[model samples]
Structures are given as C-alpha cells and as structure tokens.
Target: MKSAVEILSALAEPTRLAAMRLLWDGREHCVCELMRELGASQSRMSRHMSVLRNAGLVVDRRDAQWVRYRIAPDLSAETFALLEAALALSGKPQRVAA
Candidate 1:
C-alpha cells in the first residue's frame, strides 16, 4: 500500500495527472509520445515520470533502448478508483495511435 504522502505527491502536478490519465486504460506509452502530447521538455517530463514511478502509481518496462510506462497493475483498489475518477475529468479525448 502506498502512503498518503506518496499518493498526494504523485497527484500533485498537472503533468503527472495528465500522464496518469493517458495511462488509465492500461496502455503502455513511449516516452517520446508523452513528450509530444504534453509538450514538455524531456528532462521535465522525465522528472514527473520518476516521481510517479517512485510513488508506485506507474511502472515501466524496457524495450531495447526505449522505456514504456503505464499505470501500475498492482495499484490498490482505492487508488485505482481515485485514478479512474481523475481520468474521467482529464480533458484529453481518447486517441488511438498506430
């Protein structure tokens, strides 16, 4: 289980919230796509990613040189629900990428 501080910290930033929303459907996303979508610098985006990873709200897998990130599978029910709610309000429409 994650602590309150971890959860709060993970949900603290707009970018991180958007990242979580993007990952809500259990899809893995390449870092570059996230950068493009978020219009954020690589370093800035990476810091947000690191925070979420540390809070256990997200997870990453390496595919050769690239790392893909998604919402962690083992998230607690409450946390998952909270994330789901947040996703509902995250403004971006669902987009399918080839």
Candidate 2:
C-alpha cells in the first residue's frame, strides 16, 4: 500500500506522468514501445518505470527478453480516483507506439 505522498511524488515528473497516462487504458506496454512513444532512451524509461513500480502505481512482468508494464490492478479506490483525476486533466491524447 503506497501513501498518497508517494504516489503523487512518483507522478510529479513529466515522464512518469506521461507514462502513467499511457498505461491508463489498461493495456500492457513494452518498454521499447514506451521508449519510442515518449522519445526517451531505454535507461530513462526504465528509471521512470521503476519509480511508478516502486510507488505501486504500475506492475511489470518479464516477457521473454523484454519487460512489459501496466497500471497495477490492486490499487485502492483512492488511488484509482487520483489516477482518474490526473487522466481527466491530461485532455490531450497520448501517442502510443503501435
């Protein structure tokens, strides 16, 4: 269970916030795909993912040689509401790499 501060802190960064919004659709995404979509380097994307994961806002699974990430399924109602609010605030559509 993550505290509100931890969750907010994790999302305070631009990259992490964008990553979370990208994952809000409930689809798992490959790190490489995220890298391309965000125009971020692999290392930078991984670090941002780490912050989301550590904050319990996302979950990662090993898929062969690649790691995939998605919003955590076990989030509390408050966390879900917070995410929803954030998503609502990000009115612009995210360009997810296909």
Q: What digit string (tens of lDDT, one per residue) describes model 2 on residues 14-53?
A: 8888888778778999999899999999999999999999
Report lDDT (CA) for all predictions: 0.80, 0.85
TM-score of candidate 2 relative to the true fold:
0.89
Clash number by candidate, in order: 0, 0
User: Which regions of candidate 1 are displaced past 4 Å?
Assistant: 89-98
As a TM-score, model 1 comes out at 0.82
Backbone clashes in model 1, listed as residue pairs: none
Which portions of model 2 miss their true places by more than 4 Å? 92-98
Mind giving the per-residue lDDT tens digits that candidate 1 earns over 1-98?
88866787788799999887777666899888789999999888889999999988899988886678988889888877666665566664453431
What TM-score would each prediction reach against the true structure?
Answer: 0.82, 0.89
lDDT of 2 at 79: 92
